[model samples]
Structure formats: structure tokens, C-alpha cells
Target: MADFLNNLRTFVRVVEAGSFTAVANESDCTPGQVSRAVTSLEEELQALVLHRTTRHLSVTDVGTRFYERAKVILADIDSATDEARNATESPVGRIRVHSSPGLAYSEVATALASYQASFPAVSVELKIEQSMPGLVEEGYDLSVVSATQLPDSAYISQALGAAYSVLVSSADYIARHGLPRKLTDLADHALLQLESPVSAADEWHLQSADDTHLWTITRTPFRVNTPDALRAALFAGVGIGTLPTYTVADDLASGALVRVLPQYHLRPFTVFAVYPSRRYLDAKVRTLLEHLRATLSPALANAMEIVETFTGDATAPPASPPKRVAGTARKRPAKRK
Candidate 1:
């Protein structure tokens, strides 16, 4: 019975990941072993579930039906197990979390450490990448994603907090290139662009109290997809680029990186904790979300406060908060430092 359940879980993972090797890596096993688990299940059921070839693997009609049922069965079993264990046991299990490189470095990585310290039995594996991965397909228990608008999906998203980006350049870069005196002068300078979910690649819409300006860069001598890489390039005096204030808060405070046009910043966005099956959230996932809200909420608020401080508007009354579109901020103050 236990072996059958293990096989069922492995089969579900293989179907979602679309690769036996991927499931094997998650399980810390070999591909052949994972393939054998599927074979064993097929033999037990006396039916073919998948079409296999050296270069192609597809679900059969029967496999698709079986996959759906098996997924529900596993989810129910997990829900039941968690419910039974919750009353007496501390949350104990391995949690796989996916996050973008910037947020992982600036926030989630540290939060996970404190979470584990409190729940000593819970172990975590963090995967940092630029793209969002399927929570179930990639075997991630949760994903901490920062974006202006989250792509439509079935996963449940809990807003961790709001965050925003700002234009920044190293002091040395300013010394070498000379700061832009006005928006038009940016055209003559080395404008670094960091590609992120919330930022446009070739242009930026910088917002101030009075109005918004569309500043477009004609040439990007250096363009990067990750925020950290962009930050490094700025440190190297590659060009002036925008960064999440939280990622560069220390740098700005230490005068390592100086904010450009402190009053004008990119639009604000929300950081979300996304996961599968809101109804059956495992105790571990639920507690982790709560911990994040407590820790990251203040951190993000502090980031916004930092922006206000440097912009020399700390004493002014806060502007009207922007209206949310699709449960996310459309345009607001930068929340993450």
C-alpha cells in the first residue's frame, strides 16, 4: 500500500514536470528509478498510462484521466495527513520555494532562515531564477514573486506587501558621466536598463507628485535580465539603471549608489506569496505565509519610508494611495528598499 502511494505521487510529479529526470532530481534519485515507478503502477492497474519514446513522452487518453484522479487523491491524502498532525506536531517537512533572484537576495532568503529557526524541523530548499515556475509542476510548495501584474493563473496569491523601484547610479558613475540635469539629458548618458516584470525594457514611466514623464532610452550598451546583475553593472559604473530600493537600500544609505531624480520613481508593485490549493494549504505553507507577512510587511513599509526620507518629503502628508487593478497596485510609492 505504501509503495503504491509512493508510485502514485511519483507518477503525478512526472506528468506535471513532463520529464522523468526532473522528478528524479527532486526525489534525489535516478531517472531509471522514476520510470520504473510508473511502470510498476501501470502493471498494478493493468493499463497503459503513457506513450514513451526516446525523444517524446506523452500522456495517453487513459493517462490523462488517471493523472487528474491521482492528483486529487494525493491532495486529499496530504490534507488529511496534515489535519491529523496539526493538533500535536510542529510543522515538519521539506518545503521547496521558488523566487526571483532579487527578492530571494533582498528578503525571502533571510525570512526563510528565521522561519526555520522557529520551526526547527522544517527544512527548506530555495531555487532562484528569473522566470516563474509552475508550483505543482516544479514541485514548489510556494513561490515569492514580485511583479506589477501577476500573469493569470490558478494558483492562489496572498499579497506579502507592496514594493517599488527607483533610478540609481553609483557615485563614481555620476563622477565619470556627469548627472543628467533634466529628463532630456538622460538621452546623452549611459542609461542602464534592468529587465524585470514591472519595468519596460526600452522606456520608463517615472512618476512624481506633479506629473508622470515618459523617458525612453535609445541605446542600451548593457542590458541585464536580473536585478543583481544590473546592480553589479551599476557598481562597475556601467550606466544608470533602476533598481528595487530594497535591493539597494544599504548601498544608497552608505552612498555606494545614489538615487537619480529621487522624486521620480518607477511604478509600485506588490510582492505575492503564491501557492496551489488554497483550501488544502499544508500547515507548513500557512505558517510560513504568516511569518512572511509579519517580517516582510514592515521591511517593505520601511523601504517606502526610506524613499520618502531621501526624496526630502518625509514631513509631507502621504499622497492618496493608488487604486488597485486586479488586486495589485497600479501606481504607488515604492514599497521595497
Candidate 2:
């Protein structure tokens, strides 16, 4: 079986290389050995897998069909091998992660790179999505989200950290228009908005020392679907708009953008790592959660607090494992939510 698999791989390489001699050269083997492997595979399958000549090689009709199916089988076998090995090995499989584009722009990308470096055998596919998908149904290994509430489903959830959106404007805009002293003052300022299921692009939900109110802008200069684009507009001095702190932490430090309202925040955007209900969690998923909880979550959730309290007076967070947070029978929220 092992020899057959090797021959199958050799066949694939030969097809791609277009010559047994080329494949043998690459493999540091003789051309006859490569030809023999393919010949053995053909004999076993009783089909003409390839037609070879002095200068060219082409797949026969049977070879084309066999090659198509062979690739799938080979991939399946590799995945299965990884799964079985990972049972005893460390987390070593490809983890499919879904995250909001805004959140992903922050510590998520950094955390992923760090995790991949720590676990070189593991791979990750981080998809940027605004809508949270059903984990089990959609085949997502994990979902990283920032929301006030998550859909009550059969998934276990954990509070990675507390994140929030802040109203911001270009330094030039703030310099030219002056800062708004009150929430109502925004009525006179230009605005940019992002449309999502939970919040209307044109509507702003704000809370100040006095009260919480939803204000709809009369005139929106730009309404973009992406946080990145909205940020660009803010950079161009389009108007004042709310953006995730993670998206603008560096900008704030650089003085490119200034927080429009320091006293008021829209709402707490809590970050959560959600996964499907299962008897056992995959190591890849578990390690990713661990990494996020330990690193990204804290940095992301507390970025505003850090930026606000840059007096160099704040103490560092305790070096203990984070509390797994949730709303259902699974792990629930820590003190974070």
C-alpha cells in the first residue's frame, strides 16, 4: 500500500513535470525508476495511465479520469493521516477561523501569525466576515466576534476580551471644525456610517455621562460597508465616524486621528471565541483559543483603557488563565462581560 501510494505520487509528479526523466531528476532517481512506478500503477489498475514519447508525455482518457480521482484520494489520505497523528501529536491541523473584518484587522492577525510560528505544523485559514456563521453547519472551526449579543445556538462560547468602537476624526478635520462638546453637537458635523444587521449605518447609538441615545444622521457624506474604507474616509477628513479601537490604536498614537468623544462610548463590543458543541475540542482550535485568550484578547479588549490611561499608572493584567465565558450550559463569561 505504501509503495502504491508512492507510485501514485510519482505518477502525479510525472504528469505535472510532463516527463518521467524530469521527475526522476528532481527526485534524484533514474528515469527508469519513475517509469517503473507509473507502469506498476497502470498494471495494477489495468489502464493506460500515460502515453510517453521521446519529447512529450500526455494523459490518455483513462489516465485523465484516474488522475482526477487520484488527487482527491491522496488529499483525503493526507488529511486522515494528519488527524490520526494529531491525536498523539500536538495541535497539527488546518484551523478554519471566521472573524469580523474589523476585529481581524487588529490583534487577530498578529495572534494568528504568532500561533502559526509556535505551531509550525498547524495551518490556519482566517476568513474576514461581518456575519457570524453557524459553526457546525458551516464547518468553521472557530468564530471570533465582537458583539453585544451572540445568536443562542448549540455552540460553546468564551469571552476573549472586551472591545469597543470609538468615534474618531482626522486631526485636520478636528483642527478645522473644532471638537464637538456634546453628543447633540454631532448633528452639525459630517458623518460616515457602516451598515450591519445589529446597527444601521446611518444610526448612531451613543452613551454619555448623561444618557444613552440613538441619533440618526440627517446627512451622511459616505456610507461604506467596510470598516477599512470608513476609516479611509475618516483619514481623508470626510467626517466623524466610529471605528474599532484596534483599527485606530496606532493612528491615535501617531496623532493622525483623534477620538471624537472620550467621555462617551457607543457600546462595549465583547470579543468571543465560539465553537461547536463536541465531546472533545480539537487541539488546533484549543491552542488558538488559548493563544487569543492569553495575548490578543487582553490587548484588544483593553486597548482603549490603555490609550486612555497612558499616565503610566495602570497595572498589568494578572498572568492567570482567562475564564472561559458563555451564556448557556457551556463555559460562561468571565468578569469581562
lDDT of each: 0.79, 0.75
For candidate 1, list the clashing residue pairs, or say none: 245-337, 246-337
Off by over 4 Å in 1: 1-89, 312-337
> Each candidate's TM vs. the true structure?
0.68, 0.66
Among these predictions, the greatest TM-score belongs to 1
Model 1: per-residue lDDT, tens digit, 1-337? 9999999999999999998999989999999999999999999999999888998889999999999999999999999887667723457778889989888887778788888898888899999988789889879999998988888888999887887888888777888878766677787788887788777878888888888998888788999999888888888888889888667665665456777777788888999889987775677898888888888666766666655556743122234422112211112222223
Best by the lDDT measure: 1
What CA RMSD would you report for each candidate? Answer: 16.0, 13.6
- Give the distance in Å from residue 220's predicted Cα in candidate 2 to where it truly belongs: 0.4
Worst 10 residues of 2 by lDDT: 328-337
Score candidate 2 by lDDT.
0.75
**Candidate 2 residue pairs that clash:** 325-332, 325-333, 326-332, 326-333
